[model samples]
Target: MGIKNRLTVMSFLQFFVWGAWLITVGNYWFGTKGWSGAEFGAVFSTLGIASIIMPALTGIIADRWINAEKLYGILHILSGLAIFYIPQVDNPTLFYWVIFLAMMFYMPTISLSNSVAYNILKNNNFDVVKVFPPIRVWGTIGFIAAMWMTNLSGNKASVNMFYISGFASLVLGIYSFTLPKCPAQKSVVKNASWTEKLGLDAFKLFGTYKMALFFIFSMFLGGALQLTNMYGDTYLSDFANTPKYADSFVSKYSTIIMSISQISETLFILAIPFFLKRFGIKQVMLISMLAWVLRFGLFAYGNPGDGLWMIIMSCVVYGMAFDFFNISGSLFIETTTDFRIRSSAQGLFMMMSNGFGAFFGGIFSGIVIDKFFTHDGVRDWHNIWLSFAGYALIIAIAFAVLFKHKHYAEDVATVTH
Candidate 1:
């Protein structure tokens, strides 16, 4: 295979490992294990906690001491082992830590994969800006493929899901060893301060009012993403409890249905350039916030019966809801930040959304659902989704009122892919 194809395979398996377990784990926790929502919340929080703690540290290691590809491989190997151990963890608290361990090893690899790809592509004379997006899209396809494998094999709510994830991760880890090398920058690391090495220098952005609000909202919006990931598949799978819908395709294949969101995501990424040119970043982001409202509201009303289109439509809108803000936010950072700290600023953006945002979203959503949305061990999924919709609406209104930015088509033209 050519280098691009090899990189494509790497990208594919990178997310394939995650998709095997991520959406379906909620089903396993809530259905097979019969765990409490609050505990499951803690379980999901592992992603957030890992996101917060691991990426920057791993970046430092990849920069100073270890080759990026080797570090990426090691992390995946460790993550695979951690995941393989999860089925043996019968205790919820132990499961939380085990998953946390897996996430700590796994989360950093997402960024590391990008770094590895960028390094190899640049070295091979590929235009990363033009070539990378298509390569990265394969990761989404891999995620969809893994979801289908789990659902079709009837392992969506079983320990076998972890086995699938673990096996793929190990394979990817091994494959990573054969990829082109991305050596550490031994000399540059020697000159940078500890704070710069840790990406803490981006904290200076918070002193500016606009960037501060942007980071704050990014964190909150990130939490909203976790809310859906935590429950979307579980909600569909639980339709089996209702005799009227138990035989529905959705109930039988919730992971496959939820995979539609990832599908939409890939399509929406293609549409962002047009949207950014026409609507500018703030409007595009506002559109994303509104799209989130629609995503949850549709889920609140749609059932497997005649409202199947609503469920499908919600999945379609997911592409817009997720991609719009993330891409636009990245553009905002790219266009605004000083060149010296731009990379660290981007890291800060991920930290706020995927790290702190996901952490709070997982913790609070679980507790709130247990207290207000459960009755006799049955969940009020309708009210649950409506509450999430309300949360998105509030965030949308607040963003409109508080955050300010002026749009210049020329500015975005240079910055956008």
Candidate 2:
């Protein structure tokens, strides 16, 4: 197979491993295992905990001690084993640790996969900027496909979803070894500080007023990012408990219904360049925060019946809520930071948004839902979603009032070109 096809397969299975279980796992936790929301929140926080330390540590290891592809493959294989074991654990606390181990192995590969792909693409004389996005979109397609498979196969709330994910992860692990080599570049400066060597230099951005505020908000908004992912499917599926909506399509196929969010993600990604050009970064991001409000507010009123359009609209708005802030935030870092620390700044962005954000979102949201939203073993999803909407609104207002930036047409034009 050609390199593009090989990378395409790589990309597809990479996300397929995640897609198989990420969304519907809430169903497995709440619906299948009958776990408490607080505990399950801790479960999702595993991603945050793992993201906090693993990616940077692994990056250092891959740069010094191992070939990127080899390390990537090993991590996947170990993660697959951990995922396979998830079905056997009956205790929630034990399951948290298992999933945390799995995430530790799985999360770093997201960045490593990009590194491997970029390396091979550049080696083959392809323009990574032009060629890679098309290949990467297949990852989303793969994710959507996995969600459909999990739902249609009636494994949305079953251990079988983990089996599907585990086996795919194993297959991807072995396949990674056969890809082109990405050898470590071990040429460190003779006098590099421990911090610089570890990529901790990006933390220096916290000293700057703008970058510090940007990161703080990144963490806050990051908390908002995973709320829907954590609950949307479970919320829809819970409609089954109601007599009128019990047999509805949304309840039966919540995963597929929720796949609309991913579809919306693809569309919104295409719209970012246009939006950024017209509104600039701050305005575009503010639009994103407002979109998150709409995303959750719509969900608060949506149902599987006549209000299904609200659910769908909420998913549609997700594209803007997610892409605008994330993509624009990355662009902001790229355009503004010094070249010496740019790569580290990018890593710090991921650390803030995905790492700390996922952690805070998972732990606190779970606690809040358990404490305030749950009653007599049932959840008030309407109120739950409304609370989330309120949280997003506060973040939007704070961002508008406190975060400052001027639109530079030339800078945005440079980025687009």
Q: How many residue pairs clash per model?
A: 0, 0
lDDT of each: 0.85, 0.84
Model 1 lDDT tens row, 223-277:
9988888999989988999999999999988888999999998887777667877
Expressed as tens digits, the lDDT of each residue in 1-417 for candidate 2 is: 999999999989998999999999999998788888899899889888887888766765665668888998999999999999999999998999999999999987876776677668767887554566567767877888899999999899899999999999999999999999987665667799997676566677899998999988988898888888899999998999999998999988899999998888777766766777678888998999999999999999999878999999999999889878876786677567653454446556766777899999999999999899889988999999999999999999999999998887667544222
Q: What is the TM-score of each candidate against the true structure?
A: 0.91, 0.90
Clashing pairs in 1: none
* Regions of candidate 2 where Cα sits further than 4 Å from its true position: 1-3, 63-65, 118-130, 181-185, 276-280, 327-346, 407-417
Worst 10 residues of 2 by lDDT: 338-347
Taking every candidate in turn, the Cα RMSD to the unseen true structure, in Å, is: 2.6, 2.7
Q: Tell me the deviation in Å of residue 281 in model 2.
A: 3.7
Score candidate 2 by lDDT. Answer: 0.84
Error of 2 at 415 (Å): 7.6
